[model samples]
Target: MSAKVSAGKQVFAIVKKDVLAELRTKEMVIAMFLFVVLAMVVFSQAFGVILNDLDRVGGGLLWVAFLFMSMLGLNRSFVHEKDEGCLEGLLMSPIDRPLIFFGKMLGNLLFLSIVELFAVPIFFVLFRLEMGASMAGIFLATIFLSNIGIACVGTLLSTISINTKTRDLMLPILFMPVIIPLLIAAVSATGGIMSGEELTEVYGSMRFIAVYDIIFLLVAYALYDYVISE
Candidate 1:
Protein backbone atom coordinates (compact mmCIF):
# COMPACT_ATOMS: atom_id res chain seq x y z
CA MET A 1 0.00 0.00 0.00
CA SER A 2 1.06 3.59 -0.62
CA ALA A 3 2.30 5.40 2.45
CA LYS A 4 -0.51 7.90 2.27
CA VAL A 5 -3.17 5.19 2.05
CA SER A 6 -1.63 3.27 4.92
CA ALA A 7 -1.46 6.36 7.05
CA GLY A 8 -5.06 7.24 6.29
CA LYS A 9 -6.27 3.83 7.38
CA GLN A 10 -4.32 3.99 10.57
CA VAL A 11 -5.62 7.44 11.41
CA PHE A 12 -9.19 6.42 10.74
CA ALA A 13 -8.79 3.30 12.82
CA ILE A 14 -7.45 5.29 15.74
CA VAL A 15 -10.26 7.80 15.53
CA LYS A 16 -12.92 5.09 15.26
CA LYS A 17 -11.50 3.17 18.17
CA ASP A 18 -11.43 6.27 20.38
CA VAL A 19 -14.97 7.29 19.50
CA LEU A 20 -16.33 3.82 20.19
CA ALA A 21 -14.46 3.53 23.46
CA GLU A 22 -15.78 6.89 24.63
CA LEU A 23 -19.33 6.04 23.60
CA ARG A 24 -19.30 2.68 25.29
CA THR A 25 -17.69 3.86 28.48
CA LYS A 26 -18.98 7.44 28.47
CA GLU A 27 -16.06 8.13 30.76
CA MET A 28 -15.06 11.48 29.33
CA VAL A 29 -18.62 12.73 29.07
CA ILE A 30 -19.55 11.78 32.60
CA ALA A 31 -16.35 13.10 34.11
CA MET A 32 -16.51 16.41 32.26
CA PHE A 33 -20.22 16.95 32.86
CA LEU A 34 -20.06 16.30 36.57
CA PHE A 35 -17.03 18.51 36.91
CA VAL A 36 -18.65 21.32 34.91
CA VAL A 37 -21.86 21.25 36.90
CA LEU A 38 -20.03 21.13 40.19
CA ALA A 39 -17.94 24.09 39.16
CA MET A 40 -21.04 26.03 38.16
CA VAL A 41 -22.86 25.21 41.35
CA VAL A 42 -19.89 26.28 43.39
CA PHE A 43 -19.61 29.51 41.42
CA SER A 44 -23.30 30.14 41.82
CA GLN A 45 -23.04 29.78 45.56
CA ALA A 46 -19.86 31.78 45.83
CA PHE A 47 -21.42 34.68 44.00
CA GLY A 48 -24.99 34.07 44.99
CA VAL A 49 -25.83 37.63 45.91
CA ILE A 50 -23.34 39.41 43.70
CA LEU A 51 -24.87 37.85 40.61
CA ASN A 52 -25.81 41.25 39.23
CA ASP A 53 -22.56 41.41 37.28
CA LEU A 54 -22.69 37.78 36.26
CA ASP A 55 -22.55 38.59 32.59
CA ARG A 56 -19.36 40.53 32.98
CA VAL A 57 -17.70 37.66 34.81
CA GLY A 58 -19.52 34.91 33.01
CA GLY A 59 -17.09 34.46 30.14
CA GLY A 60 -14.05 34.04 32.32
CA LEU A 61 -15.83 31.66 34.63
CA LEU A 62 -17.06 29.59 31.71
CA TRP A 63 -13.60 29.15 30.22
CA VAL A 64 -12.02 28.53 33.62
CA ALA A 65 -14.52 25.79 34.25
CA PHE A 66 -13.89 24.31 30.83
CA LEU A 67 -10.10 24.39 31.11
CA PHE A 68 -10.05 22.37 34.31
CA MET A 69 -12.84 20.06 33.26
CA SER A 70 -11.10 19.39 29.95
CA MET A 71 -7.95 18.37 31.79
CA LEU A 72 -9.94 15.65 33.52
CA GLY A 73 -11.40 14.48 30.24
CA LEU A 74 -8.11 14.61 28.32
CA ASN A 75 -6.30 12.66 31.02
CA ARG A 76 -8.96 9.99 30.87
CA SER A 77 -8.75 9.76 27.09
CA PHE A 78 -5.16 8.53 27.32
CA VAL A 79 -5.63 6.53 30.53
CA HIS A 80 -8.27 4.40 28.84
CA GLU A 81 -5.91 3.58 25.97
CA LYS A 82 -3.07 2.90 28.35
CA ASP A 83 -5.19 0.71 30.63
CA GLU A 84 -6.29 -1.38 27.66
CA GLY A 85 -2.73 -1.60 26.27
CA CYS A 86 -3.98 0.00 23.06
CA LEU A 87 -1.19 2.54 22.94
CA GLU A 88 1.26 -0.29 22.34
CA GLY A 89 -0.77 -1.48 19.42
CA LEU A 90 -0.83 2.03 17.97
CA LEU A 91 2.91 2.39 18.27
CA MET A 92 3.46 -0.86 16.38
CA SER A 93 1.35 0.28 13.43
CA PRO A 94 3.18 1.11 10.22
CA ILE A 95 1.66 4.58 9.83
CA ASP A 96 3.49 7.81 10.54
CA ARG A 97 3.60 8.93 14.16
CA PRO A 98 2.16 12.32 13.36
CA LEU A 99 -0.96 10.58 12.15
CA ILE A 100 -1.44 8.97 15.53
CA PHE A 101 -1.09 12.34 17.25
CA PHE A 102 -3.56 13.93 14.88
CA GLY A 103 -6.05 11.09 15.28
CA LYS A 104 -5.91 11.22 19.06
CA MET A 105 -6.16 15.00 19.10
CA LEU A 106 -9.14 14.87 16.77
CA GLY A 107 -10.92 12.36 18.94
CA ASN A 108 -10.24 14.38 22.09
CA LEU A 109 -11.55 17.52 20.44
CA LEU A 110 -14.75 15.74 19.40
CA PHE A 111 -15.48 14.51 22.92
CA LEU A 112 -14.67 17.84 24.56
CA SER A 113 -16.86 19.68 22.04
CA ILE A 114 -19.83 17.48 22.82
CA VAL A 115 -19.52 18.10 26.55
CA GLU A 116 -19.15 21.86 26.05
CA LEU A 117 -22.28 21.93 23.92
CA PHE A 118 -24.24 20.84 26.95
CA ALA A 119 -22.22 22.75 29.51
CA VAL A 120 -22.36 26.15 27.78
CA PRO A 121 -26.11 26.32 27.61
CA ILE A 122 -26.46 25.17 31.17
CA PHE A 123 -24.13 27.96 32.19
CA PHE A 124 -26.27 30.60 30.52
CA VAL A 125 -29.46 29.20 32.02
CA LEU A 126 -28.05 29.19 35.53
CA PHE A 127 -26.49 32.64 35.29
CA ARG A 128 -28.99 34.56 33.14
CA LEU A 129 -26.43 36.24 30.96
CA GLU A 130 -27.05 37.61 27.52
CA MET A 131 -24.20 36.69 25.21
CA GLY A 132 -24.69 39.15 22.39
CA ALA A 133 -24.32 38.06 18.77
CA SER A 134 -20.77 39.32 18.28
CA MET A 135 -19.72 38.06 21.69
CA ALA A 136 -21.25 34.70 20.94
CA GLY A 137 -19.18 34.44 17.76
CA ILE A 138 -16.00 35.22 19.65
CA PHE A 139 -16.90 32.76 22.40
CA LEU A 140 -17.44 29.93 19.95
CA ALA A 141 -14.25 30.74 18.06
CA THR A 142 -12.28 30.71 21.31
CA ILE A 143 -13.70 27.33 22.23
CA PHE A 144 -12.71 25.88 18.86
CA LEU A 145 -9.21 27.30 18.96
CA SER A 146 -8.68 26.47 22.65
CA ASN A 147 -9.93 22.93 22.16
CA ILE A 148 -7.42 22.44 19.37
CA GLY A 149 -4.66 23.70 21.62
CA ILE A 150 -5.74 21.54 24.53
CA ALA A 151 -6.17 18.37 22.53
CA CYS A 152 -2.87 18.72 20.71
CA VAL A 153 -0.84 19.32 23.83
CA GLY A 154 -2.95 17.05 25.97
CA THR A 155 -2.50 14.08 23.63
CA LEU A 156 1.28 14.25 23.91
CA LEU A 157 1.31 14.81 27.66
CA SER A 158 -1.07 11.97 28.34
CA THR A 159 1.34 9.58 26.65
CA ILE A 160 4.10 10.81 28.89
CA SER A 161 1.96 10.68 32.00
CA ILE A 162 0.73 7.16 31.38
CA ASN A 163 4.17 5.69 31.99
CA THR A 164 4.64 7.38 35.33
CA LYS A 165 3.79 5.91 38.75
CA THR A 166 1.32 8.78 38.99
CA ARG A 167 -0.15 8.02 35.55
CA ASP A 168 -3.19 10.35 35.69
CA LEU A 169 -1.97 12.86 38.24
CA MET A 170 1.12 13.59 36.18
CA LEU A 171 -0.92 14.94 33.27
CA PRO A 172 -2.19 18.11 35.03
CA ILE A 173 1.19 18.79 36.60
CA LEU A 174 2.76 18.79 33.14
CA PHE A 175 -0.15 20.17 31.15
CA MET A 176 -1.20 23.14 33.33
CA PRO A 177 2.02 25.11 33.02
CA VAL A 178 2.12 24.61 29.24
CA ILE A 179 -1.50 25.61 28.77
CA ILE A 180 -1.54 28.67 31.04
CA PRO A 181 -0.83 31.02 28.18
CA LEU A 182 -3.54 29.50 26.04
CA LEU A 183 -6.04 29.73 28.88
CA ILE A 184 -5.10 33.35 29.55
CA ALA A 185 -5.49 34.24 25.90
CA ALA A 186 -8.79 32.44 25.62
CA VAL A 187 -10.22 34.02 28.76
CA SER A 188 -9.09 37.49 27.78
CA ALA A 189 -10.57 37.17 24.30
CA THR A 190 -13.86 35.82 25.57
CA GLY A 191 -14.16 38.32 28.40
CA GLY A 192 -13.29 41.24 26.17
CA ILE A 193 -15.98 40.36 23.68
CA MET A 194 -18.54 39.59 26.35
CA SER A 195 -17.95 42.98 27.90
CA GLY A 196 -18.71 44.76 24.61
CA GLU A 197 -15.17 45.62 23.64
CA GLU A 198 -14.36 46.61 20.06
CA LEU A 199 -12.98 43.92 17.83
CA THR A 200 -9.66 45.69 17.45
CA GLU A 201 -8.93 45.26 21.14
CA VAL A 202 -10.04 41.65 21.06
CA TYR A 203 -7.90 40.85 18.00
CA GLY A 204 -4.66 40.72 19.97
CA SER A 205 -5.81 37.99 22.33
CA MET A 206 -7.44 35.97 19.55
CA ARG A 207 -4.20 36.11 17.59
CA PHE A 208 -2.28 34.92 20.65
CA ILE A 209 -4.52 31.86 20.92
CA ALA A 210 -4.22 31.19 17.18
CA VAL A 211 -0.45 31.30 17.39
CA TYR A 212 -0.45 29.03 20.47
CA ASP A 213 -2.61 26.57 18.60
CA ILE A 214 -0.18 26.46 15.66
CA ILE A 215 2.93 26.23 17.82
CA PHE A 216 1.68 23.50 20.16
CA LEU A 217 0.19 21.48 17.33
CA LEU A 218 3.56 21.43 15.59
CA VAL A 219 5.31 20.56 18.84
CA ALA A 220 2.92 17.67 19.44
CA TYR A 221 3.42 16.32 15.93
CA ALA A 222 7.19 16.44 16.27
CA LEU A 223 7.28 14.91 19.76
CA TYR A 224 4.50 12.34 19.46
CA ASP A 225 6.56 9.52 18.01
CA TYR A 226 9.12 9.88 20.77
CA VAL A 227 6.32 9.93 23.33
CA ILE A 228 4.79 6.70 22.12
CA SER A 229 8.19 5.03 21.87
CA GLU A 230 9.30 6.05 25.32
Candidate 2:
Protein backbone atom coordinates (compact mmCIF):
# COMPACT_ATOMS: atom_id res chain seq x y z
CA MET A 1 0.00 0.00 0.00
CA SER A 2 2.77 2.42 0.85
CA ALA A 3 4.63 1.57 -2.30
CA LYS A 4 1.51 2.17 -4.34
CA VAL A 5 0.98 5.51 -2.67
CA SER A 6 4.53 6.54 -3.36
CA ALA A 7 4.19 5.58 -7.00
CA GLY A 8 1.00 7.57 -7.32
CA LYS A 9 2.62 10.64 -5.83
CA GLN A 10 5.57 10.32 -8.15
CA VAL A 11 3.26 10.12 -11.12
CA PHE A 12 1.37 13.19 -10.00
CA ALA A 13 4.55 15.11 -9.45
CA ILE A 14 5.74 14.38 -12.95
CA VAL A 15 2.37 15.28 -14.38
CA LYS A 16 2.36 18.55 -12.49
CA LYS A 17 5.79 19.40 -13.74
CA ASP A 18 4.85 18.78 -17.33
CA VAL A 19 1.57 20.65 -17.03
CA LEU A 20 3.19 23.69 -15.45
CA ALA A 21 5.89 23.75 -18.09
CA GLU A 22 3.28 23.60 -20.84
CA LEU A 23 1.14 26.22 -19.15
CA ARG A 24 4.09 28.56 -19.04
CA THR A 25 5.28 28.02 -22.59
CA LYS A 26 2.10 26.87 -24.39
CA GLU A 27 4.35 25.29 -26.97
CA MET A 28 2.86 21.87 -27.65
CA VAL A 29 -0.80 22.80 -27.30
CA ILE A 30 -0.49 25.92 -29.43
CA ALA A 31 1.33 24.10 -32.21
CA MET A 32 -1.19 21.27 -32.16
CA PHE A 33 -4.18 23.63 -32.12
CA LEU A 34 -2.90 25.69 -35.04
CA PHE A 35 -2.01 22.60 -37.01
CA VAL A 36 -5.47 21.15 -36.43
CA VAL A 37 -7.09 24.38 -37.59
CA LEU A 38 -4.96 24.43 -40.74
CA ALA A 39 -5.72 20.80 -41.49
CA MET A 40 -9.45 21.42 -41.09
CA VAL A 41 -9.29 24.40 -43.43
CA VAL A 42 -7.43 22.49 -46.12
CA PHE A 43 -9.72 19.52 -45.81
CA SER A 44 -12.81 21.71 -45.89
CA GLN A 45 -11.55 23.29 -49.09
CA ALA A 46 -10.80 19.94 -50.65
CA PHE A 47 -14.21 18.56 -49.75
CA GLY A 48 -15.99 21.90 -50.45
CA VAL A 49 -19.23 23.23 -48.93
CA ILE A 50 -21.69 20.88 -50.58
CA LEU A 51 -20.50 17.89 -48.66
CA ASN A 52 -23.10 15.42 -49.86
CA ASP A 53 -21.74 12.58 -47.72
CA LEU A 54 -20.24 14.45 -44.79
CA ASP A 55 -21.52 11.78 -42.46
CA ARG A 56 -19.13 9.38 -44.13
CA VAL A 57 -16.15 11.62 -44.89
CA GLY A 58 -16.24 14.05 -42.00
CA GLY A 59 -15.37 11.38 -39.44
CA GLY A 60 -12.33 10.30 -41.44
CA LEU A 61 -11.17 13.86 -41.93
CA LEU A 62 -11.63 14.65 -38.26
CA TRP A 63 -9.61 11.69 -37.08
CA VAL A 64 -6.97 12.31 -39.72
CA ALA A 65 -6.56 15.82 -38.34
CA PHE A 66 -6.43 14.46 -34.82
CA LEU A 67 -3.91 11.78 -35.74
CA PHE A 68 -1.52 14.16 -37.45
CA MET A 69 -1.81 16.84 -34.78
CA SER A 70 -1.24 14.23 -32.13
CA MET A 71 1.91 13.20 -33.95
CA LEU A 72 3.11 16.79 -33.85
CA GLY A 73 2.52 17.07 -30.12
CA LEU A 74 4.02 13.66 -29.39
CA ASN A 75 7.13 14.53 -31.34
CA ARG A 76 7.75 17.42 -28.98
CA SER A 77 6.63 15.62 -25.83
CA PHE A 78 10.13 14.51 -24.90
CA VAL A 79 12.21 17.11 -26.70
CA HIS A 80 12.23 19.52 -23.81
CA GLU A 81 13.29 16.86 -21.38
CA LYS A 82 16.02 15.71 -23.72
CA ASP A 83 17.17 19.23 -24.43
CA GLU A 84 17.69 20.04 -20.78
CA GLY A 85 18.93 16.56 -19.82
CA CYS A 86 16.05 16.39 -17.36
CA LEU A 87 15.19 12.92 -18.53
CA GLU A 88 18.55 11.58 -17.50
CA GLY A 89 18.15 13.20 -14.10
CA LEU A 90 14.69 11.71 -13.70
CA LEU A 91 15.85 8.25 -14.69
CA MET A 92 18.54 8.43 -12.11
CA SER A 93 16.01 9.19 -9.41
CA PRO A 94 14.72 6.46 -7.13
CA ILE A 95 11.17 6.67 -8.47
CA ASP A 96 10.04 3.73 -10.56
CA ARG A 97 10.37 4.33 -14.28
CA PRO A 98 6.83 3.22 -15.03
CA LEU A 99 5.62 6.06 -12.86
CA ILE A 100 7.35 8.48 -15.21
CA PHE A 101 5.58 6.88 -18.14
CA PHE A 102 2.17 7.26 -16.50
CA GLY A 103 2.92 10.86 -15.62
CA LYS A 104 4.00 11.76 -19.13
CA MET A 105 1.08 9.85 -20.62
CA LEU A 106 -1.37 11.70 -18.40
CA GLY A 107 0.23 15.00 -19.34
CA ASN A 108 -0.08 14.20 -23.02
CA LEU A 109 -3.67 13.10 -22.53
CA LEU A 110 -4.55 16.33 -20.75
CA PHE A 111 -3.01 18.53 -23.45
CA LEU A 112 -4.69 16.59 -26.24
CA SER A 113 -8.05 16.73 -24.48
CA ILE A 114 -7.80 20.50 -24.12
CA VAL A 115 -7.00 20.90 -27.82
CA GLU A 116 -9.93 18.68 -28.81
CA LEU A 117 -12.34 20.51 -26.54
CA PHE A 118 -11.79 23.69 -28.53
CA ALA A 119 -11.24 22.13 -31.94
CA VAL A 120 -14.33 19.89 -32.11
CA PRO A 121 -16.92 22.67 -32.05
CA ILE A 122 -15.00 24.62 -34.65
CA PHE A 123 -14.84 21.50 -36.78
CA PHE A 124 -18.59 21.03 -36.61
CA VAL A 125 -19.26 24.64 -37.53
CA LEU A 126 -16.78 24.68 -40.39
CA PHE A 127 -18.13 21.42 -41.83
CA ARG A 128 -21.76 22.42 -41.14
CA LEU A 129 -22.43 19.26 -39.17
CA GLU A 130 -25.77 19.28 -37.39
CA MET A 131 -25.47 16.69 -34.68
CA GLY A 132 -28.18 16.08 -32.13
CA ALA A 133 -27.29 16.40 -28.44
CA SER A 134 -27.09 12.65 -27.97
CA MET A 135 -24.91 12.32 -31.05
CA ALA A 136 -22.68 15.08 -29.82
CA GLY A 137 -22.22 13.29 -26.52
CA ILE A 138 -21.35 10.05 -28.27
CA PHE A 139 -18.92 11.77 -30.61
CA LEU A 140 -17.18 13.38 -27.68
CA ALA A 141 -16.94 10.03 -25.95
CA THR A 142 -15.35 8.52 -29.03
CA ILE A 143 -12.80 11.30 -29.11
CA PHE A 144 -11.96 10.74 -25.46
CA LEU A 145 -11.42 7.03 -25.84
CA SER A 146 -9.40 7.45 -29.01
CA ASN A 147 -7.23 10.09 -27.35
CA ILE A 148 -6.39 7.63 -24.57
CA GLY A 149 -5.09 5.13 -27.09
CA ILE A 150 -3.07 7.80 -28.86
CA ALA A 151 -1.57 9.14 -25.65
CA CYS A 152 -0.56 5.73 -24.41
CA VAL A 153 1.11 4.58 -27.62
CA GLY A 154 2.47 7.98 -28.55
CA THR A 155 4.09 8.48 -25.15
CA LEU A 156 6.01 5.25 -25.50
CA LEU A 157 7.01 5.91 -29.09
CA SER A 158 8.06 9.45 -28.32
CA THR A 159 10.39 8.20 -25.65
CA ILE A 160 11.84 5.69 -28.08
CA SER A 161 12.26 8.21 -30.86
CA ILE A 162 13.61 10.97 -28.64
CA ASN A 163 16.89 9.10 -28.32
CA THR A 164 17.33 8.49 -32.03
CA LYS A 165 19.45 10.53 -34.46
CA THR A 166 16.47 11.36 -36.70
CA ARG A 167 14.06 11.85 -33.82
CA ASP A 168 11.50 13.97 -35.68
CA LEU A 169 11.40 11.80 -38.79
CA MET A 170 11.41 8.59 -36.78
CA LEU A 171 8.37 9.52 -34.66
CA PRO A 172 5.80 9.72 -37.50
CA ILE A 173 7.05 6.54 -39.11
CA LEU A 174 6.93 4.73 -35.80
CA PHE A 175 3.68 6.34 -34.73
CA MET A 176 1.39 6.22 -37.80
CA PRO A 177 1.50 2.49 -38.49
CA VAL A 178 0.93 1.61 -34.86
CA ILE A 179 -2.05 3.96 -34.56
CA ILE A 180 -3.90 2.72 -37.67
CA PRO A 181 -6.07 0.33 -35.67
CA LEU A 182 -6.99 3.13 -33.31
CA LEU A 183 -7.81 5.47 -36.21
CA ILE A 184 -10.06 2.84 -37.77
CA ALA A 185 -11.94 2.31 -34.52
CA ALA A 186 -12.25 6.04 -33.82
CA VAL A 187 -13.38 6.83 -37.36
CA SER A 188 -15.98 4.08 -37.24
CA ALA A 189 -17.38 5.25 -33.92
CA THR A 190 -17.42 8.88 -35.06
CA GLY A 191 -19.23 7.89 -38.27
CA GLY A 192 -21.84 5.94 -36.35
CA ILE A 193 -22.46 8.97 -34.14
CA MET A 194 -22.67 11.31 -37.12
CA SER A 195 -25.12 9.04 -38.91
CA GLY A 196 -27.50 9.19 -35.94
CA GLU A 197 -27.10 5.48 -35.32
CA GLU A 198 -28.12 4.13 -31.94
CA LEU A 199 -25.40 3.84 -29.33
CA THR A 200 -25.71 0.08 -29.46
CA GLU A 201 -24.74 0.18 -33.13
CA VAL A 202 -21.46 1.88 -32.37
CA TYR A 203 -20.74 0.03 -29.16
CA GLY A 204 -18.53 -2.46 -30.95
CA SER A 205 -16.13 0.18 -32.15
CA MET A 206 -16.15 1.80 -28.73
CA ARG A 207 -15.30 -1.52 -27.16
CA PHE A 208 -12.46 -2.03 -29.64
CA ILE A 209 -11.05 1.38 -28.77
CA ALA A 210 -11.36 0.71 -25.06
CA VAL A 211 -9.54 -2.56 -25.50
CA TYR A 212 -6.90 -0.85 -27.62
CA ASP A 213 -6.35 1.66 -24.86
CA ILE A 214 -5.94 -1.01 -22.22
CA ILE A 215 -3.61 -3.16 -24.28
CA PHE A 216 -1.26 -0.39 -25.40
CA LEU A 217 -1.26 1.23 -22.00
CA LEU A 218 0.00 -1.99 -20.50
CA VAL A 219 2.48 -2.48 -23.32
CA ALA A 220 3.80 1.04 -22.94
CA TYR A 221 4.05 0.74 -19.18
CA ALA A 222 6.03 -2.47 -19.52
CA LEU A 223 8.39 -1.10 -22.17
CA TYR A 224 8.86 2.53 -21.08
CA ASP A 225 11.66 1.78 -18.67
CA TYR A 226 13.65 0.10 -21.40
CA VAL A 227 12.99 2.88 -23.88
CA ILE A 228 13.99 5.60 -21.46
CA SER A 229 17.09 3.76 -20.36
CA GLU A 230 18.46 3.68 -23.88
TM-score of each: 0.93, 0.95
lDDT (Cα, 0-100) at 173 in candidate 2? 93
- What candidate 2 gets wrong by more than 4 Å, as runs, is 1-5
Supply the TM-score for candidate 2: 0.95
Candidate 2 per-residue lDDT, tens place, 179-198, comes to 99989988989988887778
The count of residue-pair clashes in candidate 1 stands at 0
Deviation of model 1 at 175, angstroms = 1.0
Clash pairs of candidate 1?
none
User: Candidate 1: global Cα-lDDT?
Assistant: 0.83
Clashes of each: 0, 0
For candidate 1, write residues 1-230 as lDDT tens digits.
55456777778888899889778888679889989989999988887876677656777788879988988887887776777787787677676888988888889898888899898888888887677776777788878888899888888888788889988889889999999999888887877877777787778888998899999888887887787875
